[model samples]
Target: MTIWHRSARFHYRFATNRPVAPATGVVVDLSLNIVGDFVSHGGFRNYNPDITRPTPHLIHSGHGTMAFGGRTWDVGPGDVFVFFPGLPVEYADDPQRPWRYRWIGLEGPLALPALASIGLTPSQPLGRIGDPATVDRLLAEALSGTVERAFPPTRHIAMAWQLVAAIAAKPPAVDVDTVVHQLATGDPAAPPSITAISRRHRIAPSTVYRRATATLGIAPKAYQLERRFDLAQRLLAGRTLPVRDVAAQCGFNDANYFARAFRRRYGVAPSQWRSGQI
Candidate 1:
């Protein structure tokens, strides 16, 4: 069997491994991998820079926007896009109409060649497949291995091979990135400079800056700051950290500046907000 196929079974078995706590006076150490199936409401609203690859069938189901190679495309129900490795992509929820979808995460390296036969190329950006019944059947088969509890390790490996075959046979459009961009910039605290972000992601600085302004309507640095500040607000409300420390953790070099920024965004100081919450 191919390495990709072997990886699929490895991941499936790892995910299904049951954990057993140690008995009295004994410690049990096991590197158990966990896999889960879930349905989520609301839309995905962030650019995932970590662990997202141009794998076949990486995306399960959802509606959102994918920005690739200087173009932004709308994705909704019945839309599927495939990407290649090392490509920079960003996705966010539609503000006017959010999304709800089923999702699963698998870790392995087998099943690519079979998938490639279906048009999943490391060079392709986005591909669309609109067949509902086939999609459902593939999903069902994947789930069968997950739900059977004691299904043999080889069975899951086999199921993964089947899953890839099913996906490759379907028709879809692959959307590729025009240019890669910085992965993190727009958080709640401060947006880093485009030059800084671009350098980090190894793409042209201009591309990072342009995409941030054109697609997100804000600079990359500004977007990053928002995320920092957003986290600060949560920490403050939870009373987990002191004000000065919170400011530092949120990326503010000065407590006074953090306080000022906090007031401007939430209309109250962090300390006051924390006390009010209490």
Candidate 2:
């Protein structure tokens, strides 16, 4: 494999001296690119470029959006897209939030057939999988090192095949239970909002609200607050940290506001709750 590019933000590009024959399914190039927010202008228009590329490419977006094929897709994390060989297509980052993605370029007589069997085509080349993290990990493992001696060709082929299979498998829809759990235990730094969650799951906000309320017997907001307060209670009970610190840890920035919210929820100050006093 020849390294065309490498970067600390996990951008990688590679090519092989010996192309995979039409008989053996194999990957010719693979890349993991984290096009950060710093990228101001990034777009590609491919219309039978001078260079010949005899392989289909599969791209998995970790985050951000892209405009392609005469429409803009709100490509959230875990979304996948494909580009067939010799096709004319244009794509660009959503300037506001640049994308991070992994792509595998594949060559073989079975490439298009395999992709078609799974309903991925140039016209409709988007799909999702059960485990985006696992796919990302596999791509990382297959493309590790300085590209001087990355994974051997055989290993790379195997990894690429595995990824192809995963993509071909129909992914289950995001369920209401999973959304509820995410709201309850999502990252404090990036609390899950109804809009964001709905977008991530590719559903309407109203659907998320209706499903969550039907399943959990509480509005999503109320459920999230209950979980946040539960976390706050645990933090208060387990530590000697200041009330303000506990509040911040629970996703509240203002101590007074946090206290008021806590009082409304528990009928006691956070300090009093910590002290087991009603």
**Regions more than 4 Å wrong, model 2:** 4-12, 15-17, 20-62, 94-96, 150-157, 169-175, 181-209, 213-278
**Candidate 1 global CA lDDT score:** 0.51
Q: How many pairs collide in each candidate, listed in order?
A: 37, 0
| Residue 47, model 2, lDDT | 44
Superposed by TM-score, candidate 1 places the C-alpha of residue 225 at a distance from the truth, in angstroms, of 41
The CA lDDT of each predicted structure is 0.51, 0.59
Model 1 clash tally, residue pairs = 37
TM-score of each: 0.40, 0.52
For TM-score, the strongest prediction is: 2
Candidate 2, 1-278: lDDT as tens digits: 54554443334455443343224663444322211111222332224333133233334433444444566444545566665665544555543334555556555555666667767776667665545666666655655532445444456456656777776554558786687667656865346677767655666788778877887688867777777787788789885899999988887868999999889878999898888833
